[model samples]
Target: MPNLPKKVRSKKLSSRVDLTAMVSVSFLLIIFFMVVGELSKGKAMALSLPEKYENGWHHWGCGSGSNERTITVLLDENNKIITYTGFLFNPRKAPKEINYGQNGIRKELFNQKKAILEYSTALGKPKNGPIVIIKPSKKSNFKNLVDILDEMAIINIETYAIVNEFTTEESQLLASK
Candidate 1:
C-alpha cells in the first residue's frame, strides 16, 4: 500500500427550490381578491320601506313616503327601462303602456309625467309629487343606471330609489312564516 493519508470527507450541499411558481400563484391570488373587492364596493346599503302619508297613502317624494301617490320604475337585466307601473292617474288605476324600445325610454318617461299631471289634477292635489321609485336589477349596466338617473332629473322627478328585486318564492315564504 502506498502512503495512505488521512481520509477527507466532503460535505453534501442542500438543494435550493426555485420560488417562481409560488410567486406566480401569490400574484394570481392577489389579483383575484382585488377584483372581488372592487365588485362588492358600494353594495352594502340597507333598504327601508317607502314612506306613507298621514292617511296611510305612501308617496316616494324624493325618496320619502307620505301616503300620497307613487311611481314604480323597474329596470331589467339589460339596464333598459322595462316596466313603469303604479298610479297613471290615481293610485288605484293600472299603469299606462310602457314601450322600452331604443328610443322609447324617453317617450315613456314623458308619458309618465303626463300621467302624473293628469292624476294630480284628477285628485285635486298639487302637480308636484314625490320622487319616482327606481327598482334596478343587481346586474344592471352602469351606463343604463346613469342614463335613467339623468332622465329622472330631466323630468324633474327629484325623489327616487334603487331597489333590488324580490323573488316570488321569497315573498311567499315570508308571507307564510
Candidate 2:
C-alpha cells in the first residue's frame, strides 16, 4: 500500500458567554437611580422681595409718600404684634396692639383691607389697597416672623415688605409698650 494521507480533523470553539450577573447588576443600578431621584424631591415656600427704583425708593412703600396706602406691623418680644396705618412721622391713625390668631391680626387685616377698598371706591379712583410693612424687632423670634408671614398669606396680601430698620416713632411706641 502506498503512503496515504490520514483523515484530517477540525477543532470547534464555543461562542457563548455567561452574562447573567452583568444583566442583573445593570437592572439593580437602574432601580436604585429611579428611587433616589424620586426621594430627592422637596417642597419650599417662595419669598418675593420688593425691588428698589431709580428714585431711591422701594417698590413697596419706603418713600412713596402714600401714607394712607400702607400698614406697618411691628413684631416685638413676647409674641406681641403692633400695627399702625400710614407713616411713622405722621401716622394716619394711632397704633393698635394685636395678637397672633385668626381673630386677632387676621381680623384686623381684613377690616383694614375692606376700609381701603371702600374708601377708594367712594373717591372714584383706582383701588389703592394697603401694603403691609413687617418690621421684626431685635427681641422678636423667628417664629413670630413666620407667624405674621403666614397671616399675610392667609389674607391674600399681594404686596408687602420686611424692613429691618425702626423709625423714631416706632421705637417710642415699642418703649411705651
Q: Tell me, what's the RMSD of every candidate?
A: 10.7, 6.4
| Per-residue error (Å), model 1, residue 125 | 1.5
How would you encode candidate 2's per-residue C-alpha lDDT over 1-177 as one tens digit per residue?
998999888767678888999999999999999999998988666665545544322435454435776788999999998998876666786798999998999999988888877776776755667688898999999999999999889888877888887766678898798
How much is the lDDT of residue 45 in candidate 1?
Answer: 54
- Cα misplacement distance, residue 167 of candidate 2 (Å): 1.5
* TM-scores of the models, in the order given: 0.47, 0.65
How many backbone clashes does every candidate have?
13, 0
Instruction: Show pairs that collide, candidate 2.
Output: none
The segments of candidate 1 whose C-alpha lies over 4 angstroms from its true place after superposition are 1-68, 87-102, 165-177
- Candidate No. with top lDDT: 2
- Candidate 1 per-residue lDDT, tens place, 1-80, comes to 88999879898787888899999999999999999999988877544456554443243444322323456665555444
The candidate 1 region of ten consecutive residues with least summed lDDT is 168-177
